[model samples]
Target: MRAVTYDSYAKDNSRLEYREVPDPKVGPGQVLIQVRAASVNPVDWKVMAGGLDGMMDAVFPVVPGWDVAGVVSRTGPDTPEFAPGDEVMAYARKDVVQGGTFAEYVAVDAPAVAHKPAALDWAQAAGLPLAGLTALRSLERLGVGPADVLLVHGAAGGVGSLAVQLGRDRGARVIGTASERNHAFVRELGAEPVSYGDGLTDRVRALAPGGVSAVADFVGGQLETTLAVLTDGGRHVSVADPTVEQHGGHWIWVRPDGAKLAELAAVVDRGALTVEVAQTFPLERTGEAFDASRTGHTRGKLVLVP
Candidate 1:
């Protein structure tokens, strides 16, 4: 099997290289997947650069990716939920391994995966697990409903885009902040788009005169700005900054939940959710994908077709 892996942690050292590595074997409660596609998230790059070294207790020669869509090639002895050849998608547990998705095959915990929606292709399904789960978890915390007005920062990016759509599906009125170039795309996701730079708070306030009922700040730098437009005791959440305790908000770190993934799959099957892939690259181009993500302006998710 060929894989993209790094022996050390640094931007300069994170070059892609191919090697004849042994394929992973499934253990108890695990399933081996023939990876078709995997999406890159900020966590991927962060882990690659050792940003979470203290938190994760990572080892060297890590492969960093969590979002995957593939076909089950083998199931462990005790696994009864799925069989060989089942199409599946999942977010890998962040702590077990840095990432195993940048390869032809990888072993995943059976409990972390759900059946992939037949309506979606590998690339689209690959983009959903991490971002979609984050959106679902944050919205659940917000308790958003038809009577509420929800605000999402960085609405054109992966998590923000999904959050906007999921919020709309739950009947919440959504207002999203993005760059001018992504305004139309964000609006198409069922949210009113507000420009994110300079006076963004005022722009959001203008859109929701009475103030938003909840806020999800995908971009942590705009914390103060988002706080300004949220009503008192309004649900506030951030995925980027977990240290944020000042605004009565909680930091949301997405976890692997097959039940939630099942619900997300149903939404996708019913045409209520969509996964947008801005670009796709081969495993050898992992470094380039990280570079693209660092530019901070990708319209949607970036994926790797392994």
Candidate 2:
């Protein structure tokens, strides 16, 4: 099988190579997915650069991706949830850093796999797992509901965009912070857009006067902004910053739950949710896809078709 592999951690993505690699082995409770599409997350490049070295161990020549959407080619023992020919998607991160979704095939634990949303094509479905799961987890931690007013940082980002819609779906009045260029896009996602900069607090205050009831920070370094605009007893969470824990806010690391992903897929199929794909790359151009993700300006996901 051909896949993208990096020999070692570096400051940049120059080491990424597209070449032949052995097909992943399916262990009990795992399923083999013939990779149709894989999406690039900032974490992919960060992992390639050893950003997570303190927490996770890495194997050399590591395949680099976690989000996959494809057809099930085979299933291992004890996996009764799915069979061959099933269209599936998964947040396929493992404790060890190897056998990722950037390959022609990947073996995923059945508990982490969900049937791909029929409403989404391959690229959009590939983009949904990680980002959607992160947003769902963050909102769940914040306890967003009809009575709460939600403030989302980086509103136009991959996770933030979904957070905005999911927050609204849960009946929260969402206020999202983005640049002038993304205000309309944020609005389209069902949030009142506020410019994120010098007068951020004042801008949010103008919209919510009393203060927002909850905050979900997708872009890190927004702790000050979160504190400034949140109500005194409001809940807040961050996926990027861990220091939020020190201040009564939760730091979220999304767990893989096939049931929760299946629920999210239902939302997409019902037309209450949408997945945005900014661009698509052939499997071999993964490095270029990483370059685009590093820019941090793309409104949606960057996916690779294998």
Candidate 3:
């Protein structure tokens, strides 16, 4: 099998390499997937550069991607939820050492995957798992509902884009913050777009005079802005900065839940949710994908076809 991997934690170009590798074998509760597509997240680049060195325990020579969409090629002994040839998508467990999806094959835990939405292609499905799950967890933790006014930061990026659409589908009045170039794109996702810059807090205040009921900060640097617009007792959640214990807000680390993913797949199939793929590259160009992701201005997810 062909795989892209890093020999050490460094910049994307310093370590990422595409090469032939032995095929992975399934374990007792794992399923082997013939990967068609995988997507890059900030975490992939972060891990590749050793940015999560203290926060996460990772083995050297790690495969970095978490989002995967592919066909099932084989299953472990006790697995019965899927059979060979089922199309599936998932966020592989963060704790895994060698099971990342940036390859021709991956042995994923059977309980971490669900059928890919029939309405989406392999690339779009590949973009959904990690970002979609993060958005879902953030909204769930904030208890956002139809009557609430939800504020989302970095609304044009992968997780934020999904969050905006999901908030609108859940009946919340969605407000989003993004750069001037992405204002129209965010608006198209059904959120009131507020330009993110020096006066972000003021912009948000101007839009929602009564104050925001819930806040989800996908961009960690905008913590102060999110705090400024949220009303007292408002629900606040962040997927980027989980150490926010001082502000009466909660942090979300996306977990792999096949059942929750199943529900999200249903929403996608029903046209209630959408996954955006900003760009696609072959596995050999994984370094280029990481460079684009680190630029912090990608309109949506960047995918790698393996």
Clashes of 3: 1
Q: How would you encode candidate 3's per-residue C-alpha lDDT over 1-306 as one tens digit per residue? A: 889988777864777888887788888888899999999998888777777777777776777789899999999999989899999998986574545889999989988899998999999999999899999999999888998999999899999999999999999999999998899999899999999888888888899988999999998976787778888889888877866656888888888988899988988988988888899999999988988998999999999997
Tens-place lDDT per residue, model 2, 1-306, is 999999999878789899999888899999999999999999999999899999999998899999999999999999999999999999999999988999899999999999998899999999999999999999988889999999999999899999999999999999999989999999999999999989898999999999999999999999998998889899999999999999999999997888999989999999999998999999899989999999988898999999
Tell me the TM-score of model 1: 0.97
Query: What's the C-alpha lDDT at position 286 in model 2?
Result: 91
Task: Give me the candidate number with maximum lDDT.
Answer: 2
Which residue runs does candidate 1 get wrong by more than 4 Å? Answer: 13-15
Which of the predicted structures, 1 or 3, would earn the higher lDDT when compared with the native? Answer: 3
Instruction: Find the 10 residues in a row with the least total lDDT in model 2.
Output: 9-18
TM-score of predicted model 3? 0.97
What value does the lDDT take at residue 65 in candidate 1?
81
Ranking of all predicted structures according to lDDT, beginning with the best and ending with the worst = 2, 3, 1
Local distance difference test scores for all models? 0.87, 0.94, 0.88
Between candidates 1 and 2, the one scoring higher on TM-score is 2
- lDDT over C-alpha atoms for residue 283 of model 1: 89
lDDT of 2 at 231: 90
Scored by Cα lDDT, where does model 2 land?
Answer: 0.94
Per-structure clash totals for the candidates: 0, 0, 1
